[model samples]
Target: METSKETSSNLVKRYQRYLKLEKGHPENTLDAYLRDLDKLLNYFQGEGKSPLEAELEDIEHFAATVRDLGIGARSLARILSGVRQFYRYLVLDGYIKNDPTELLESPKQSQHLPEVLSTAEVDQIQQAIDLSKWEGHRNKAIIEVLFSCGLRVSELTQLKLSHLYIDEQFVRVMGKGSKERLVPISPRALDELGYWFIDRNQMKIKEGEEDYVFLNRRGAHLTRTMILIMLKQYAKEAGIEKTISPHTLRHSFATALLEGGANLRAIQAMLGHESIATTEIYTHIDTTTLRKEILEHHPRNIRYREEHKL
Candidate 1:
């Protein structure tokens, strides 16, 4: 029989290989799963119990402990998923008789809607930029593309100059799961991008970084944190009090497209969302606009009395 320590090490190795080969999980995902397993193992060790010999009660207790430690339901759900995967692998490898987490259920999570900025507010933010400086042009282009394309910060940061088809009025974006999609670029955004590109070419781009569109002072790719900082500064300068981020621009983009009568499927394709339900949140209709339309077109509302008639 394999010792608990040996079994644990072997299980970790197998999990790593499974994540790399079968799941094709990214490095960050793999790291998070590994960390979850590590916490489980440490808990087992503290109780002087072997992981291979742990019962369903031990798993439940560990989950309860995590809850008491202030871990949110979403995080707990992810940890449970990792544990279930691990146990399924163990069972397949003949190390376990049954899955310990078979009866476990994920905790309920609240669904929050995405925040969107109004067109007027968006214009206000754009107008607040100081256009005298070179960075001003670049910032404008960044904000324009963010709203026009509905790009994730990572996708925006990793965008390449080669992916732009300005003449075609479309840009190819690489989204989550490395999925690629073509998004139509508005004329105004295209003009801003063109201006920034001219300025960008004048800068001394570092080696091995020529393909990247957006770059930092060191001519490297922009970090996610920097994008957040830029949005905060822009919002402050614009005197906007509501909380906003690069993601807020994406939400605003989706909202605007839906309000403008864009097709749901077309919006989904542009957003690169695999699930239609994920794209449905952008379909918020304006009740006030609907009421005005009804009042204007209704036959009863159109009836008029003769002038000066009582």
Candidate 2:
């Protein structure tokens, strides 16, 4: 018979493989889940219990200790989610008849809506660029690619020259978890990218760094922080007040599509969202635009207006 320690180790190893192969979780996410599970294992060991034998009270005690450790609401919620999945895995494998985490409730997270840029604001920022400087062309291309494709900052930074298919109007992107998807590129963005390439070819690129799509003046690929700083500078120059980031452009891309009557599932596909529910937040973000469309086209609204005409 296996000792409790051996059983626990084997279970954790099995769970890690499940997350990697079946769930396809990214490295950082998988690491976090494993750490959370380790916390649970430590708590169980203190009580002379194995995870398969943990009771509701044991889970509750773990939660209390986690809280006492001053974990933030968001982090605490993620940790609990990991722990719950662990219990669920045990039940599915027949190691436990019931999940101790079945009754667990995650803490409520505050709803913070993503900020989006208006079309005019976007135009103002891009138009404010000084194209005389060669770096200006590169910066313009960065902004266009970000807003046009709704790319994550990291994705934009790591984009390679080989990934772009200008003739096909598509750019291949390796998204979270190394999941590759081809995102459509707008003509305006493509035009700007072509212009940047004209200037890019003149630069003396560094060894082993020739394949990056966007590079700094020194020929190294742009960093995530540099993108954020550039956005902040442009936002100031455009006189837009609300705080913005590269992600603001991504949110704006989705919001504009939603307002333009694009299908939600199509938007989900373009944005590379794994779940439609994850993409549904845009519906909530554009309620005012949605209301306008309903009032303009709904049959009841049309009838009411027609009858009230004097």
Candidate 3:
């Protein structure tokens, strides 16, 4: 559970098992559901109740509480989804007579396009690195791999030296649910990693950490938080103001491919998205980009552009 959690009940454990063995929820998704469940249970505790006894009004109040805490609509929807699933399971097993979440209204979430770094912005960030520092070497490599390969931060952190098939121009990536896929590595990304290797090889590699590809000064695999912090600092130094995170690179990768005329299914496979629907979000970004370009350069829109200029 994230933030605050109440004592978990046996029912929660059983539902967790069902989600894993039966529903086949991926590991990260399972963790999210459990965390959301914690949030729900904690809220219910404050009401002198449990999820098993939660009323429709009680659920609505919980949703408002989550909103008050400033969770975004999409996240609130996910948390409510977890709650709905739990009640559904309880009803399925006859533990409850009614499903309180059945009529619950989820918050509306708009389809917002994610921020993408232009190739120039990417180069600017790379140039901002101070190569004299050892971290600069590793950070540069990290950014290159992230942009070039489009890995989830967890997948990147879990990457192993043996997973790199440099001669074949691919790296074996362990994606969500422990699934494996091969993502092509750009020469530029590989070259940065080569430089990072010079520093990595000289270190007294720690026991059991020898196989991991990216490491901290302590020789352990870099945590996901470390990557988040590093990217923010680089973004600031590069003076690109839009919010950035590991997912931004991944989103940019997909959008770039779509704009370059790559098949949507191909991009989905490369990103290891289980559903094509999950990969379709890039199309929205591509549409926004297309519209911007048309308004900026299309001869017919030139006057309109000038008229609309802020």
Candidate 3: where is the Cα deviation over 4 Å?
A: 1-7, 10-111, 276-310
Question: lDDT by residue for model 1 over 1-310, one digit each (tens)?
Answer: 3445666677789878988888899999999989999989888878888777866557867886787678988998899888888888777767778787775545556644445787677768888888777677888888888886778777898999899987776678887547776666666677788888787888888998999988877778776667878888888888888778787888787677667665555555566664456646534534333323322332212222122231
By the lDDT metric, which is better: model 1 or model 2?
A: 2
RMSD of 2: 15.6
- Model 1: lDDT of residue 15: 75
Name the lDDT of candidate 3.
Answer: 0.77
Task: Between candidates 1 and 3, name the one with more favorable lDDT.
Answer: 3
Sort by TM-score, best first.
3, 2, 1
Q: Which ten residues in a row have the lowest lDDT in candidate 1?
A: 299-308
Q: Please tell me which predicted candidate would have the highest TM-score against the true structure.
A: 3
Report lDDT (Cα) of residue 216, candidate 3.
94
Tens digit per residue, CA lDDT, model 2, 255-280:
77777666565566667664445655
In model 1, the runs with Cα more than 4 Å from the true position are 1-111, 276-310
